[model samples]
Target: MLQIDLWKRVLIWALVLCGLALAMPNLFYSRVETHNDAVKAIAASGGVASPDQTAEAAEWPSFLPSGLVNLGLDLRGGAHLLAEVQVSDVYADRMDGLWPEVRDTLRAERATIGTIRRVDSAPDELRVQVGEPAQIAQAVALVRDLARPIVSLTGVGASDIDVSAEGADVVVRLSEAEKQATDTRTMQQSLEIIRRRVDEVGTREPTIQRQGEDRVLIQVPGIGSADELKELIGTTARLTFQPVVGRTTDGSADPGARNLLLPSLDNPGEYYIIEDRTVVSGEELTDAQPAFDQNGRPAVNFRFNPAGARKFGTYTAENIGSPFAIVLDSEVISAPVIQSHIAGGSGIITGNFDVEESTQLAVLLRAGALPAKMTFLEERTIGPELGADSIAAGKIACIVAFSAVLIFMALSYGFFGMVANLALIINVGLIFGLLSLIGATLTLPGIAGIVLTIGMAVDANVLVYERIREELKTSKGPARAIELGYERALSAILDANVTTFIIATILFIMGSGPVRGFAVTLALGILTSVFTSIYLTRLFIVMWFERRRPKTIEV
Candidate 1:
């Protein structure tokens, strides 16, 4: 009948084979497997993202019989979580967190402050004390709020603002109700501080929200691999650099308070106290990375922006030979005394940290920063037994669906039915081979997509065969009939697949998650079926015709 040249036959067969190879992974491979727990633990323990991704295969063999489609999260009984960021408290806490330094540092300069202390402080004020009766007038004049109503006004025109001295037997007490109110306000500030810290660690699609005044609920799915989530949500401690107080202009220590030396963690090192204040903070970090020093000891290298770098250099310069604390969330991770002024925008954080924590820190730093902290509300791991059940159910569905298609094709078109069966067989083979070659995850809906492909692919052969019968019945010669059959059937064949293709395109564009998997399989099936049915099957027919010459055509 239709004469397919040897090259056309070979080329068509090659394409069919290629498609099979690409689909192999979908048909045979297990989609759901195992997650790395070691990395997850690290993540929880203040580790970072970018864990070493070397995962070992589970010893338990796959329960999935070969050649099945896999379902996605919905049918697979996986957990999902929703969370939101806490912003209100985060901003308020950040401002207040910076307020203390703003207050006392100005006082050491003898700048007059008012409303500086809280009434047992419901909200701590940077109030100014009336200086030794005489300097008070001059101090108030220079530091006066230029705008009216900015500083609280009392005593007609504030001839003098009054306050008890910081160190005298002076005492200001709050009533029971006032203390409760102050504590509530501070808790609000603390809650906001928590949020800013969480936002610093950019866990993917993480949801952080204020549950009560002080707590935030966080949900991170697909992020439960290691303690990374734990670490990410909790590292909200802030870092600050303050000038040393009670130090003389010549750098000699004053009598007390400012020169206090605190012991370093697990070391003989000590850090000299600066003014009991913090000026610059670690809120503007841009990037960080893990590297090794000359001795090959693991370390974390960091860089800050122009603003951060300039401030950092200034802090280090002033604190040379003095220890500065690297505080995480609240606990000090490292408090190394500064050896020298660290300028030029970058520096290293070093300690007894192993390679893992150092790298995790770098990754956390590079994920920019989290805006707020979170508390893990819930977590669960899918059992391998459940994965096995899914695999088994998926197989049964595929087998039942597949056999039904096979039986229908055989009965519907008789001799041509057999040819359709051959094409169908090749179609599925190509699907598996192609999936394996490409290594696409085979979800369960993806299986349904493959099964649906059967109806579409089988329909194409039916169209061609039915058209061939029409042409043969028209009394044309066998060669002309066969050629015209393929030619005339091409328009209808293409039209049917083109319509299905449009549907597949819509599915691909609109679907999310597993629905997308369906669309992908459907789209791929449409293309493969068109090529194999029209091209490969025709080639087979051509080769058969060449070998089996007959005198007359059978009606």
Candidate 2:
């Protein structure tokens, strides 16, 4: 009997209806996208919306499914940047942090190693000269105690820094294995910080990923330009509070070896000499928000954690009437005198900032600083006009291919061909439905995959139809012929589609960006095609045969 069980029939139709419902929003893509954006904006504004936003949000019914396929960078047009992280900067920072520990450790062994002074070398190397040349070996041994085990898979049992004595100086630098591990960690941290900064702007589906040892690839769709993306992420935003030594009007003035000379934010040509040691850094910040100061000026309010609060309070208590500088990215944003002990662990940063600047600063501070500076190696801004053209072309290609396939199938296989046509249409719908469900971005290559799928979708139906034609010649009844046709062709269909699915899976695993996009659509198309070809079309034919009670039917 050419029959499907009652429950299976319900399941098939249910899935078809659900898929179509999920895909319906893509037909009104722009309107639904606008509605979604408006809804998000309203929620972000604490359930308040402007008249325009409210109207836009109301354009689409809330009861219906609203998820749409996200367009990729190539499809939506946006900023593209390939940046190389200045990973060596982190080495310098690490050495700077290690200096105090080395100084204190050597001072503890001062009786044997004598006094020590830091000598200039490469930015990455920490060279210290011992007053007693004969005890240089002792100084090296003491500094070596400061080395910690590298917590990395390839660096097991290896210390982070290699300490050796050269002449009268104790030379210390990161080990080669430790450098590799640090590079990996720096790239990971840079990628994460960039992602956080981009996500804070509320963009849809930005791709920020590590490309190589010291590089990151960032593609942000719907952004204005590449420069805008750069400006958003490039600032580092390393905030610190340090005690001020003095103020100067000269840029070339030296502030000693352990201090820094930074320019003021508001006053032109005015600089301040600040201590290099920070009282509390941005890493201790628990929260930051854009708010107005007491004078109604734009400012950023920040709160610190308990440990940071204790340190800050103690410093303020001891430094009454002394000025402290708020430094951001090595520039003095503010230098204010401490009037009394500030025990609240909260403070405000007031600079020459507008509302937008303050908001951006708050966002950057909240996102945390990038581990290292990144230099853009490649940058390109895609225009919306190009994206629109590509989308239009893709739509035309899909429609033409679809119409040609439908016409050819209808003429060759007759009624059965039309059934295959219906299945193919539903197959495409299910693909989009799955894509939307997964929040997958659709690129130009993904569209090409869909067009290819339109042709491949009917392969199983064709095999089954040809098999039925052969069975009919062997004098079998229409029902038996149809049953045997699907049963016999099942192995071949599975073999072909399964092989293709494996290839798609491999491509998805090994590829990135647009290649993965193509693989995703291809894989989904295969699954949906198999379901429709083997089950849904067969169900329709079985229902038709049962209704007519046909003894024989033409292929």
Candidate 3:
């Protein structure tokens, strides 16, 4: 009478087989990884496979599951960087953008203010000198009118900029509340841009997270070095098209008002004096691709959105025959003369760039520019050898713990313990299988969690075996004792594992990085262990009991 139904038995075996099959790829980790990469590369290349990729893809069969547990930084080796975003740079950019609006506003009130000119001030401050000192109040009032209400919750109803008269000049600066909002937005944007850039390289399990107020922590598991990562992310790649005022050989040439002198990228010592006001910024770009120019030279082609297209078309049409400077990261890449009206918002950037440079530029353009500059605070390149050592140590610890648990269970509970030990093995396989299915990164702490799980996995079997022994002492038959053992132990097993599962969930939600990795494995181990102990182990016992038809048994 102690028996599992046909459907339940089938389900248990099915789950076990599925778990083992999914976890099989890890046995040949490098081969499967290579095959997966080759497949992905072929897919990315529009299904056109190279000879090497084809050979690599053939290493693994197409019918089998290919998922493998992603190794974490502690297991894989990588780059780590702590970067401090120069948030105040955003304030400078905001002020520079505000100047055009402020100039246009004051020009409309020229009758009273006479004339207005941007004067020297802090990078974060916009100071305008009013020709008519008597009308300074009117100038301040006009500038203040340009201030829009901050859209953030904390800064609701507060103006974005603070305006006041500094002697004869009206001084404008971002308000404290607006600065706080900008800092938050800047950090978020930086994080996103960094993530996109890292993802573009097709690396695995990169950690890009915000630290304190303006710091970002980036841990890339497969990058060569921190310097390499810094290079990939540090370049702002801020592309802008601006009206070129004139070309100059002098680096320190005065570009007059509202103009910038930027060095040409292709020609050393030559500079382009361009309007600081952007005709079209890279933020409006929707697509960028590396392609060959008319002369077969490597170049980048870019297409802008509708609004950007309209503005670009209007600017080019109105300024035909004048040169427009294509600026990247404060340097002029090229100053091409516009012979006629160029519409459609599509253009080419031709410079002294090779194929790799063009491709990298395209990637950066597609990813968008960082909102502010970042200063690297801490940088480290974890070597693969060290990671291998950690992995080896973790493996030894898990094996020792696993063997000890298996031996203890077998010695203490005898034949019943062997069944539980088998279930424990399946439980671990299920954990790895689940991790693979979800593409979870396994850290050293995650391995520790698995080891801890192995020890705890036998608790349910212990309770059931003790109950059976007690029932047998009360003169109950073997079949009846086994049934009562599982039935009575079910509540205790659920209560204990349920509480542990809740704690694991809380840790996952509240923790990050390695802590979250531990939580994930711990939570998964709980589920799998519970299934194996209560269901799989019971099925094994019931099958053995039904076949043997024993009169008496020892737990």
lDDT of each: 0.57, 0.92, 0.92
Question: How many angstroms is residue 325 displaced in model 3 relative to the true structure, after the best TM-score fit?
Answer: 4.6
What tens-digit string does per-residue lDDT give for candidate 1 at 1-555?
457777876788677756654444343334322322333444544664443423322211334322323334434443332233344444435335534543444355454333233223323323344335445444434433221221222222332112233431112223233334434544454444434434444332233444554444543323433255455544543554444332222323343654343333324343334444554556666666677766888887778788988988988887688766654443335666788988876777776678877876676555533454443555554444565686687778878877887788778766557777788888877766555544344566887888898888988887888787888788777777767878888999999889988998998797655667777778777887888788877776667667886544542
| Poorest lDDT segment (10 consecutive residues) of candidate 1 | 146-155
lDDT of 3 by residue, 234-334 (tens): 99999999998898998887999998989999999999888878889999999998888999999999999999999999998998988989999999998
Q: Alpha carbon lDDT of residue 308, candidate 2? A: 92
**What's model 1's overall lDDT?**
0.57
Ranking by lDDT: 2, 3, 1
**Residue pairs clashing, model 3:** none
Clashing pairs in 2: none
Once model 1 is optimally superposed onto the true structure by TM-score, how far is the C-alpha of residue 429 displaced, in angstroms? 4.5
Candidate 3, position 408, lDDT: 94
TM-score of each: 0.61, 0.92, 0.92
Steric collisions counted per model: 72, 0, 0
